[model samples]
Target: MTTDELKGLKVASLVDARGTACPGPLLAAKKAMGDIESGEILEVYSSDEGTKVDIPKWCQKMGHDYLGVVEESSYVRMFLKKS
Candidate 1:
């Protein structure tokens, strides 16, 4: 989806992993996954630069649908659908 489309997603869960680093954001996404059902959307707010790559990779490895990301002034918003 486009960045605008990603920002408009109806998130089932939101994980504010901002200020956290590396595995922190990825771990939060993983942990938060348990709280959402299949097909639901999970929105992750992260500041770590690696998260821009980590999340999509994790989603791929875990078989989830990595929708897209929205870059903010100081952070990024990632969107994914549980599988």
Candidate 2:
């Protein structure tokens, strides 16, 4: 979805997982989900390359929806829709 469309959706937390390693982004994303409503989205920003793989796998294993990933100059943005 477009950034504007995503902006319309509720974001529980913008987890800045940048500079963190494996499991760190996932951990933060999971923690962020806890603070939001069930259907809300948790947006995660991470510099760790592992996030590209780990986040999706974690989402699958946890039964959450891995929306998509956006790449930026120095980091990547992962969008997760809580189920």
Q: Which consecutive 10 residues in model 1 have the weakest lDDT in total?
A: 2-11
lDDT of 2 at 44: 93
Residue pairs with clashing backbones, model 1: none
What count of clashes does model 2 give? 0
Q: In terms of TM-score, how similar is model 1 to the real structure?
A: 0.96
Q: Per-residue lDDT tens digits of candidate 2, residues 1-83?
A: 77556546666778998988887988888888888877778899999998899999988998888888778899988888888
Q: In candidate 1, how many Å is residue 64 off?
A: 0.2
In the order shown, the candidates' Cα RMSDs to the true structure are 0.7, 1.9
Tens-place lDDT per residue, model 1, 32-79, is 999999999999999999899888889999999999998899999999
True-structure Cα RMSD, model 1: 0.7
Per-residue lDDT, model 2, residue 51, is 87
